[model samples]
Target: MGDDDVLATLARERGRALFGYAYLLTGQAHAAEDLVQEALVRTFARRRVGFTPDSAEAYVRRAILSTFLDDARRRQRWSGVRHLLGRHDEPARDPAPAVGAVLDVRAALATLAPQERAAAVLRWCEDLTVPEVAARMGLAVGTVKRYLSTAGHKLEALLGPLPDDETVPLTSGRTRP
Candidate 1:
């Protein structure tokens, strides 16, 4: 098949799944779609370099992740202005409890150092294994474990125990919320 044919076929098969991956990372549907579309466009443009089928998916996924992270950093830099201009439309579902819970978690998370926060989020929120988290964050296994432990201790002090039904899994250990 020609390069265009191959790229089209890959997009036809993997586009939705790629968008879903982006959505998982971003927690925003429109942003995820935009990220995925941009990644695909970049991939198509680079097809002249002869990307293989197996590597194409990984390439696009990495691009999407990098794009999402870059956008997050940019948004953080301009968040004050964005918040001032943004609408206050709430989610379709009642997000009060969820928002409160997330805010609480975020507040507690902010107490930890950057590496600790990244370790905890990767282990708990992303449900990645310790090795996987270490690989992604480019930290040693021991360092990741230490960060998790430190983060867990701080969270425990800040948030206290969870209710019987609510469970929180941190990098170091799991706690009942």
Candidate 2:
């Protein structure tokens, strides 16, 4: 199949999984859908040869993650100077009833820094190893480990005690920022 066909097939067959992955990272359905669409556009924006459905999916998934991380970084940067822009915070509203039990986990996740949440999701939900998560996030293994440790602690405080496997042994010695 041609690249277009491959992408179409991937979207038709694996759409839910792609959206679910994005949703896990975003914690909002609309945001997750937007992420997936952006990733698909990014993945296919340029013409390329020999893209299979599997490869297309992989590329889209990676794009989704990178886009999410990039957007998070941008939002973090904006937060620092947003008050200077004279924009007032909107009044908080109750979450929709559909949010239900997932609210606790999503609320806890919202407390984590973007990188920390990504690390936790990649490590625990995706079941990737520390090194693998590091590779996916383009961070050093030690950095990923530290992120996991911090996230684990924060998540535990909010969600109650986590499982024993949540801990990551930090390396001794100073890390250069």
Candidate 3:
């Protein structure tokens, strides 16, 4: 199959899983879609000699992880620089659906260190094993476990009580009650 054909097939087959993974990693719908799109574009933008179509999905996923982590680091650095500049500005507009059952959960997730949040998402939401998460994140397995544990503790404090397993659904595709 041609490169485009291969990518299309992968999207059709794994789009939902990919989207869910992005959303959990990102905690934002629009950003998640953008991340997925960017990953796809980067994956197919150019195919290397050893990059087989069968490995495209894995490649896109690795790209997504890289992109998300890089963004988190960039934002952290920018936040510090902006602080030095005394540019403490609030968001210009309120978030849509400002109140919902999942808002607390999302807010709580947002408070986590980026890597910790990523570890929790990969383990619980994406249902990946610790070793799998470590491999995806290019970290040692022990570090992944530590992140997951730290995230679990913080989430429990913010959420009151939560399951050790993945209790929170990745997406909140419903009207606020």
Q: List the residue pairs that clash in candidate 1.
A: 162-176, 162-177, 163-177
List clash counts for every candidate, in order: 3, 0, 0
- Model 1: per-residue Cα lDDT over 125-174, one tens digit each: 77677898899999899999899888878888888853322354433454
Taking the tens digit of each residue's C-alpha lDDT, what string does model 2 give over 1-177? 987798889989999999999999999999999999999999999887888888899999999999999999999999999989665876665777547736777898899999999999777766678998999999999999999999999998888876554454222322223
- 1-177, model 3: which lDDT tens digit per residue? 678778888899988888999999999999999999999998889866555556888988988888899999999999878867554575555456556646887898999999999998787667777898999999999999899889999998988866644444444432223
What is the clash tally of candidate 3? Answer: 0
- Candidate 1 lDDT (Cα, 0 to 1): 0.79
TM-score versus the correct structure, for each prediction: 0.42, 0.49, 0.46
Taking every candidate in turn, the Cα RMSD to the unseen true structure, in Å, is 19.3, 23.2, 23.8
lDDT of 2: 0.87
Residue 104's lDDT in candidate 3: 83
* Clash pairs, model 2 backbone: none
Candidate 1 vs 3: which has more lDDT:
3
Span of ten consecutive residues with least summed lDDT in model 2: 168-177
Candidate with the greatest TM-score versus the true structure: 2
Superposition error at 162 for model 1 (Å): 69
